[model samples]
Target: MPIFLEAKLLVWLSPLHRESWLWACPELEEKPYAIVPSPIDPSQFYDMKLPREGVICVTSLFEFKGRKNVLQWARDHPGQEITCAGGNPLPNEPLPPNCRDVGQISPWQVNETYNKHKAFLHLPATPQPFDRTVSEAYLAGCDIIGNKLIGALSYDWFKSREEVAEHCGNSSKLFWEKIEEVLND
Candidate 1:
């Protein structure tokens, strides 16, 4: 009588942000995880780089604007660290590590990356239907920082970009306070 994208429930089953980001990077299918844009590959728009400033992968244009603000704040404060990667899910951005294919990365590998990274930076550069990045980072256990409010199925798990900036401007306590509020519930 009827059909579906795959016939299965196609569940959104995730702790928070994992599933959405996995799909964004086709190259990551084997490993399947989110990553910053790949500079070497122009077509597969993964992470965004600001010259000597640094790099960040945008979940979408909406996220781009939010990250820009963080960039400005980080510039003023200076000294923040970020790591990048990519794979097949992206037709736009290329993978940074030539051998350790992102699409094929195991959960443990993904966890390793997560442990080293401080937070997930998602700034919606534009206003669109919804950006799934917030959920991706949350699911992966990355401290999410962004402007776009993804009040979707998990309506309670996001914060405005402005909030993130405030936390950045203030002490680390504020940062965890916000994170606890959003994810703990």
Candidate 2:
């Protein structure tokens, strides 16, 4: 913890993450910090514009990822089919009948998965510094349905597809620019 405190600047993935950190380490309020989100290549995901419907969750089935919430959502929406694409379920954790686990798929398959669904659901039990899947799902033309824990949703870009893509395209440059500024100081 002391080693981490020695840093000149702390770059956070989102405002929510920054706030969370500040809450935990109030003393760090005196330190320099920046909010720079992770980038998502727009090319890797595209809106197929198919007749999309239902919901899909692209998250690992772990407790921290909100495996319990996922199950609850499936149970709540008995009529709605919730397709999940991720593996590593905690032992003895079975998904509800409406929730179908497609297991873990390659990154290439994620775009296709989003295309098939109208909405993307992400409800992590704990706060995620940033969940790139939310941005990727949005880029693929899926409506994002997530809780406040998803750090990406706290940013303005998450509201519009164009803004999301633009941010993704510029994120790398922005990150480096921040780094340069920190080094120059």
Candidate 3:
């Protein structure tokens, strides 16, 4: 299920993300971390200048075919730390030393993490059309960022990318000031 980001919260993304920090797993303390999308792209955006030490990587993690690819992906990259929650874990696999399983975090945790860090990262390049992570991250006060693969939307694009980002950035102060702007017109 996809979460619909309210128009009031979309404006925050407008400001260039300068925090240089990302909501990451506790295990990140011990490793060089990076955020990567679920549908891995070896070519697109390859060779990123890894962020400075302690700078969190804002990237996507995903639930793949009853097996969480994000977990294995993180394992493959020993030094990279990752954040994964909100769904069932990959069954029968041994927990990787670097993977920090936060379990299903409550919405409050998302909000708290957003406030304390740069943003809650999880822009998995999922082909399943719309990804609810956007709405969840925004509602939690994160600046909803997009992964490159952006396949589909739950509603018309006009409704999602537009209003959701608008609400996230709070394009109109009135929208943030007034509750009316939270819903689709």
Candidate 4:
């Protein structure tokens, strides 16, 4: 049996995933499906008084998450500090001097890290379903930079990492609106 037939509603984190599903099972197009990006509750994040600084990357220390790319980016930008918050470094993989590994952090801690960082970096080896961290970082007012395969949303179309901060202010509200549209449908 097709899984779509068994579900009341199908929610996809990205349009790419939804399109792929419909392409694979064209019959499922009749089913109710929504392309809703991941959500982040603003209340969970702290608003910082100090100016944000440095570049921050949050992902598991796995190779697929593009840890090497982030390390390389850190090395390339010698003057800027880069902080990584996620699972510990892989065995025998030492972080670059410009990059500081914070290991794994709680959601709240991630919010704080976003509050402090000037930019967020993510370079996945494969396309991401929907990176919740992108939304969280936007809500925390950090500039976004990295893989174009992050999601189906407009943020993925951001012109540049440096310009991403300008779009951050309204993302949280838009995120909720999309969720409401999905739920109401």
Model 2: pairs clashing at backbone N, Cα or C within 3 Å:
none
TM-score of each: 0.35, 0.95, 0.39, 0.71
The per-residue C-alpha lDDT of model 3 at residue 180 equals 49
- What is the TM-score of candidate 1? 0.35
Highest TM-score scorer: 2
Encode model 2's per-residue lDDT on 1-185: one tens digit a residue. Answer: 67558988889999889888888988888788878888888988889878887999976477788887877877888998888888756636667888788878887788988999999988999889989998989999998778999999989767789898888768899999989999998
Residue-by-residue lDDT tens digits, candidate 4, 1-185: 45678765777767666765676788888877655555445555445755789988888356777767777777788898988888755846777788788777875577777888998888766566677777667666777787665762344544443333334434556657656776687
Alpha carbon lDDT of residue 75, candidate 2?
Answer: 85
Candidate 2 segments exceeding 4 Å error? none
Estimate, for each residue in 95-126, the C-alpha lDDT of model 3 and write its tens digit.
Answer: 56765555666654544444443344443533
Q: Write the per-residue lDDT of candidate 1 for residues 1-185, one digit (tens) a residue.
A: 12322222222222234334344533333431221110111112122221222223333322234445544544453455433333334445432331122334453354345434446555444432334444333333455655543322233323543332232233245434544554565
Model 4, residue pairs in steric clash: 86-103
Ranking by TM-score: 2, 4, 3, 1
Of the candidates shown, which would achieve the greatest lDDT relative to the real structure?
Answer: 2
Candidate 1 residue-wise lDDT at 151: 23
Taking all chains together, the TM-score of candidate 4 against the true structure is 0.71
